[model samples]
Target: MKKTLLTLCSVLCCAVLFAQVPATEKQALLDLYVDTQGDQWINTWDLNEAVADWHGVTVENDHVVSISLLFNNLNGKLPASLGNLSKLRILELSFNKLNGEIPAQLGQLSNLEVLALNANGLSGTIPETLGALSKLKQLHMSSNKLTGTVPASLGNLTAVEVFNVFDNDLKGSLPAELASNNNLRELMIAENDFVNTEIFSVVLLSNSGSGLNLKSPSLSPQAKTIIAIESPEDGN
Candidate 1:
């Protein structure tokens, strides 16, 4: 009888010792695999095992913090469950064949710092909900089929250092508020149909310390006039 009690207690202890990751997070990864068609992926997951054992997934303190699957040939839409990774800090899924709109639920990742989704087949407008990511520092969504104007609410990302959305079909004037964020270093929006581009001048002036790489479509004559007015006067 004593042997049976000892064995049962040991089993309970072992279960506690090897507690799996949170169901929400585990399900999030599974959703990603299924939605993104991980079966066709270059590096695929064995869903029967722990998520921590999955490739390109980084976990800390039993929580997922990063998912680096760049150039992995993932083809499909990004699942909404991905936003459940509240502890996620870096999400690098660039250079994939994923399509569909950027999930607004991603704004729930308040701790996110780097969001790299460039070089995909994604289409649709940038979600304004992304402004909720106050900790975000780098946002790369270039070389996609994204359209619509740059979200003015993105100016709320005062911590942002690099913002690139070039080589898209986007149009309309850039948000004037984007200039106030002095932390910005690289602002690439070229190959789009942006107008009233005086915002770039303000960004340059405020971001003097950072190595700013500003790009935009060919400015309209009026925009050129604004740039000329904003330019420093030549010293006599």
Candidate 2:
């Protein structure tokens, strides 16, 4: 009886220790699983299993760093608790059926580099808090039902190289500060309702082929002349 009791105590102690590393992170994953219909997942995670063994989850030194579950058939609104993954670097949930507004709390991920939540049914405005991800390199949330103007705060992503938010219902003028990001390579904001666009530097679009198409901006005669001079020639 004493031997059995000792074994049970050891098991409980190990479970407690496992739960201690970033309690919020562990609970956040559990909440995400429950909210996103884990039972319907193509390769469902066994909640009883260790964190490292959970499918699509990448843990390093007991810290969740990446969650790449692209096209895994996730079909629900993302839980806000997901922002608690402080060490998260890449969060790719594209090609799913996720809907609803993106959690503003995602700004808390100071270490995030790539955030690809494109090709979903998500709607609502891009959260201003996303600008806080100073380390962010790529931000792709295209082919969605999102509306509202592109937040000017996004210009703060100085390290961003690819920023694609195409085929949406966004309106308003493009922020001029976006050109300040010298690292920017591709900026696809087509098929929207933009009435004005801040003329970007020639260097920014030197390699930007036919994909860059903005509506005729409401500008002065001088501005129009400048645009003609800087515009890349057709079929160039």
Best candidate, lDDT: 1
The alpha-carbon deviation from the true structure for residue 194 of candidate 1, after best TM-score superposition, in angstroms, is 1.2
lDDT of 1 by residue, 1-236 (tens): 99999999999888765667799999899999989999999999988777777899988878999999988999999998889999999999888998999998998999999898988999999999899999999888878999998888887998987777766888887777666677865566556677756555432221122332234544434332221111111110
Tell me the TM-score of each prediction against the true structure.
0.79, 0.78
- Candidate 1 pairs with clashing backbones: none
Q: Which ten residues in a row have the lowest lDDT in candidate 2?
A: 227-236
Question: lDDT by residue for model 2 over 1-236, one digit each (tens)?
Answer: 99999999999888766754488998988887887888898878998888878899988877999988887888889889889999999888888889999999898899999888878899999999998999998887878998998888887999887777766889987666776668876666666777655455431221233434555454334332221212111210
Cα lDDT computed for each candidate against the true fold: 0.78, 0.76
Which ranges in model 1 have alpha carbons more than 4 Å from their true place? 1-17, 202-236
Superposed model 2: Cα runs more than 4 Å off: 1-21, 201-213, 217-236
- Cα lDDT for residue 103, model 1? 92
Summing lDDT over every window of 10 consecutive residues in candidate 1, give the lowest-scoring window: 227-236
